[model samples]
Target: MIFESSHCPEDSRVETQFCQNLVAQANVDRAITPERSTSISPDSIRPKPSQAIQQIILFTPSRASNPQIQAALVKLQNQVAAELRSRGFTVQSVPTGLDSASAIAWINRRATPNTFALSLQTDAFLNPDARGTAAFFRAGDPQRQQQAEELVKRILRNVPTLVDRGARPDTETAFGRLPFVRQLSVPAIVLSVGFSTSPQDRNILLTRSSAIAQGIANGLAPRPVQARSTTQVPIRIRLNGELSENQGFILGGNAYLPIALLNGLAINFQRPKTAQLFT
Candidate 1:
């Protein structure tokens, strides 16, 4: 998210400390999980776990005209790749200085159905006031749209100061089509972190680099979703004809509202001592 400021701010000690804390937390969350019991019965056999789909291909625009912007993009790309590697992702970064066609070809040669690709670039405009975070996906593709939304959402969560330009189709881009989003065999997204022309945005890109990288890493490789029961399916909830942010679930042909939602509505309910409610 990008916001306007009067001057380009220097990286303060406070910002450095904050970034360190965020990166540390991200590492802990991604690296640690609960351990299963080690003791096993003699007759029991352990099944081999399926291989994880954690491959990622990351790259940045090789032809950025501005030398300063190009250098910053490379730095941000390396920061994101390092963060993802710390989170146990197998990240392959396309070499810098490759032209667009060659970069796309390199990714295509390595991409598979299980691979996810992300191209990072800072936006620029004649109008310096135009500054914000935006992501582009293949036009009319739901999966790409979902991935783009998640990417923007994660970034905003990490840095709320920037305006959310929202997820857009590649057709809406100035170029009308981004090969990185359209030509790759795997799911792909093109992220515009912020407008390099805007001083405020440049300050953010400089000071909040780690947070931005962590946000990108989080979006690209989100935590694994827990298995759901077959009897349960997600359902949207509505209140007074307005959609509620909190979702409920349909279980055994019945719609169940979450306790948190009921509490928000000021509804009073008593729980039995033996009852367990999961939100």
Candidate 2:
């Protein structure tokens, strides 16, 4: 965010030139930044349950060398992808014995407006003593960034025993951005499920793999609307924080919305030419 209070010229004279110079300097600084990434807005294609989410890519990125590491990573990847598929998600994984880059490349080439990617990794780079989960998302694209954070929160709920490291900014200046997340063409989240070197963290991965995968699935899944019961509470409705006449007082709490809003319901009136109507 630009701070106009500090930077704006006190005198209005030659303000345009001052503003132009500031913009030029900002552009130059941006050019020198190595972490810069191209961004796209997905306004037309935010994933919806029936139409938006067509394919999900489950990827474990490293090209492991050790025999044990390679076999174990592949098994984890397969099982997680399997769990997502079982939840009725269309999931694709790197076929047995193939390099991760190939699978990632395939995903990039075939990425549709309606797909999302899940990049799974064991966070061994973090200190061995540090334990818990973290999720990462590229900067920009608020909807995509939010999806990443919400999924992280959902993962936390399922894996309650583990410490919550929370979500990390992929574009933070201290840690240069993650390349895979930066380049991936779809909305993506990088999940560090646990630390491999930490024994307890390792145990969580070994024991709760399915539950974690299921949590991720639930985060992305279209929530089922509860059948409206006799119980109801009236509330003034707001859409995206703004209230409109189209939005009237409805039966629900702001903490959670009713199914009528989720799937959409309309109150309609039919009038005859001569009729004077009362609501």
Strongest candidate by lDDT? 1
lDDT of each: 0.71, 0.59
Candidate maximizing TM-score = 1
In model 1, where do residues sit more than 4 Å from their true spots? 1-53, 224-279
Residue pairs in collision within model 1: 1-162, 2-162, 2-163
What would the per-residue lDDT of candidate 2 be over residues 1-279, giving only the tens digit for each residue?
Answer: 011112222223465356546656545555796444343323223333323776888777553433444455556678767766776778877455445457656777877777788777665422357567777766655666677778777877888877686776555422234545656667777777766656777677777776777677766774578775534444567777976344333233323344355455463434459843222
User: 200-272, model 1: which lDDT tens digit per residue?
Assistant: 8888988888899889888877766766555768899879999999998876566777888889989888888
TM-scores, all candidates, are: 0.61, 0.58
Where does candidate 2 stray beyond 4 Å? 1-51, 63-73, 96-101, 173-175, 228-279
The candidate 1 region of ten consecutive residues with least summed lDDT is 1-10
